[model samples]
Target: MKRLLVYLWTAPTTLVGLWLAPLALLTGGGVQRIDGVIEIHGGIVRRLLRRCTLLKGGASAMTLGHVVLGQDRTVLELTRAHERVHVRQAERWGPLFIPAYLLASLVALLRGKNAYFDNPFEREAYKRAP
Candidate 1:
């Protein structure tokens, strides 16, 4: 089935997502299955996310594999489509997505570009988001 293929393809990132699920749940947040991806919302995720200074430019959500961690429900709703693209990227890149994304940011920074906006993954997501 297509679903099975997607599950298998995203397994690596899903495994990492599993580790974050508990934290999300413990912080009063919850996870939901959306279009075959797991969306994590609410709780201390927002505070926890403050650690990612690279996201200083108003990024309110982040996608890890099949899992999405949002600052709040509203932010999640607004960005679901964009995050889904990231889920698909995770499916394609597996666990390598994180490092590859970071590398892309680093490359952009080296080029004196806005790291997040110039990163190819972000550029793709921005282009796809509605």
Candidate 2:
């Protein structure tokens, strides 16, 4: 099951090009290929190239190995730590963690906290980033 989900998560951007994917670039850093997966700071994002209808604002999307974030305004802006955090969360929780992560993220947003900062997963990514 983990392998299947990993395959699904990585199929989109891996098949294409990392540059062409919906990756967030840090101020002085960018995506890097590591031993296991593409490591963006402490966050591990899956790459897949597919015809997706979940993108918003533009023709490109940077989803976190899921079908959500489609047409999401936040997803519109490509931030390094923002998306990277989701990657780490997915890594620790596996594929079934999206729903819980999304809920927590939304609650944090409603509380007027920065999603990328207040989010536990994102917090980890940011803390571990160089």
Candidate 3:
């Protein structure tokens, strides 16, 4: 099936994203499938989003392959559209998504742009969903 191929193509990246699932679960976070993606929130997901990213106050939600990590359930709901854009991007980029994403950020930084906001991927997501 075409869908199966897409899943397989993205599986490597998805596995990288899933690295945090158990940690999230053990730390009091939660996980559920929504619209064919895993959405995770609370516990360590909360702490990571609040402390570990490039944003001043941290991101409300982040998508890695088919996984979306959020500060909470409400944040997940609010950012679902935005994060879904990233999921589609992952489908397009396949296993190369992370490296390509990081490269895009680096390119933005080198060009004197805000890495997060100016990265074309983020730009696309914001344009489509914001």
Q: Could you estimate the TM-score for every candidate?
A: 0.87, 0.39, 0.96
How do the residues 1-130 of candidate 2 rate in per-residue lDDT, one tens digit apiece? Answer: 9867775664453343344324524322234443344533211222221233222223223435422222223333444344455555565455556556567678888999865448676566557652
Question: Which pairs clash in the backbone of model 2?
Answer: 10-47, 11-48, 11-49, 12-48, 12-49, 13-47, 13-48, 13-49, 14-47, 54-70
Residue-wise C-alpha lDDT for candidate 1, range 17-50, written one tens digit per residue: 5676778889888777777677777776767666
Candidate with more favorable, higher TM-score: 1 or 2: 1
In candidate 3, which residue ranges exceed 4 Å CA deviation? none
Worst 10 residues of 2 by lDDT: 41-50
lDDT of 2 at 37: 45
Task: Extract clashing residue pairs from model 3.
Answer: none
Name the TM-score of candidate 3.
Answer: 0.96
Number of backbone collisions per candidate: 0, 10, 0
Give the CA lDDT, 0 to 100, for residue 58 in model 2.
Answer: 32
- List where candidate 1 sits over 4 angstroms from the true fold: none
